[model samples]
Target: MPASRDQADRTQRVQLPDETGPVPVSIVHAEPRWFGVPPPLLLFGLAASLFVLALVLLAVGSWPSGLILLGLSALLTAAFLETARRRPGSERMRAAHSWTSSRLELAREHAKRLAEVQGLRGRRAVIESERRS
Candidate 1:
């Protein structure tokens, strides 16, 4: 049976350090082959074209050429599947780690700006009170 779309595409919730506390982030795990392999469109197109060429060769009475092309196409498809199955989980983890780190840095920067603004507001209130006295 084929794997479901949910199984192929997984989402993980990661806790990243922030200025205030740990922040929960949802990270969608994209295709494993996205960064490592050729585009799916290109791979599929090549396989399909090869299959079609094989059929055309067979129609033209070139049995040997047709068989060779068919075998090549099958091998290409199997190689792609094997690559996907053997892809390391470490790559995905690394990508998620980088994404979380960047988000955490942004949160810290925002918190720092907010703290500065609050400090300015407090100073203004003190000045106002002194003037009223």
Candidate 2:
């Protein structure tokens, strides 16, 4: 029917095993951009590579090139550190990490309480059985 076709055109539906009928889900695509700056890890990797190359050059007696590369590597490393410090999602990442740690602590405490309760229940059951006997 025209109504069914219109509905189908408006929303894509998917059949789920746990659902009674088709569910419509909206698809979304998000693109992440670094605002024209290279990722900190990439810069760090380049810096490390440069440092290794500099060491190799120095071992091969290329003192001038080696010194230059060494300086460049140091500069790149500084830039990488600065970028990583000022990255947009760094605070969010830290917050998420702290939140996860707190949640883990809470879960651990809950588990400990549950274990104690289970142990007490088991002891009470044993005592009651002995009394009955």
Candidate 3:
């Protein structure tokens, strides 16, 4: 077969069956699964509760201890919020890394298959030339 015909055959699209009927999906990728509420919300809640407890301490007679608790709560809140902000980006990075690695693996497999085909073609061409000579 000619190269153009082979190329067209490889480029042909296939339809897949789904609940919505036949869909022409090319590249299949899925979003990462979420099991529960994000950690940041929980961390912020904890910080808020701590701040309330510190206020209660201040209302009572422990000024030194209340100040300490308030400072700690502030620190925890800041850390948790920062972590929350970076969490999505980091998760996305990991997902992107996984996607990139999979693509590389697919490319490698395709290259190997193409090399095998080219090797067979070269052998066939050599035989044809020998026959003609």
Candidate 4:
């Protein structure tokens, strides 16, 4: 079955305690792609731009310098792709962690009475007890 909008909305919203003096809390969401470009495409673009620059340098200047730039570009492109490969997995993990935490917070809040009435030993009780510690 499809998930309910109410559960989705709870994850989208954040609650923070109000106090006279306390540090600010912020939630940041990472986008799946950088600047709307997928990592592979971005890597390609980086390499292409560098290759073009290296050609221009070779044409206008020296062969050694142009080759250096070309090599640097390749190295950079490889490094970027290596690092970016792990982003999607980390993003998925972060999102799952956030949703579960939100559900637990809601259980602690809305299920307090229900838990007490049900003799205080269920998922709700676990949530409430976790909140106290």
What TM-score, over all chains together, does every model reach?
0.37, 0.41, 0.38, 0.31
Residue-wise C-alpha lDDT for candidate 1, range 1-133, written one tens digit per residue:
8766885577778987566767677899775445656643345456668979999999999989999999987766555444434553466534544554466589789999999999999999999999999
Q: For model 4, what is the error of residue 88's alpha carbon versus the real structure, in angstroms, after optimal superposition?
A: 3.6
Model 2: runs farther than 4 Å from truth?
1-34, 88-133
Candidates sorted by lDDT, best first: 2, 3, 1, 4
lDDT of each structure?
A: 0.69, 0.77, 0.71, 0.67
RMSD of each: 30.1, 23.5, 32.3, 32.2
Question: lDDT score of model 2?
Answer: 0.77
Once superposed on the true structure, which residue ranges of model 4 sit more than 4 Å away at CA?
Answer: 1-46, 89-133
Give me the runs in candidate 1 sitting further than 4 Å from their true place.
Answer: 1-18, 21-36, 83-133
Candidate 3 lDDT over residue span 89-124, tens digit each: 466544544554466589789999999999999999
| Candidate 4: tens digits of C-alpha lDDT, residues 79-130 | 5455445463566544544554466478678788776778756768899989
TM-score, ranked from best to worst: 2, 3, 1, 4
TM-score of candidate 2 against the unseen true structure: 0.41
Q: After superposition, how far is residue 114 of candidate 2 from its true place, in Å?
A: 56
Scored against the true structure, residue 111 in model 4 reaches a CA lDDT of 83
Q: Best candidate per TM-score, number?
A: 2
TM-score of 4: 0.31
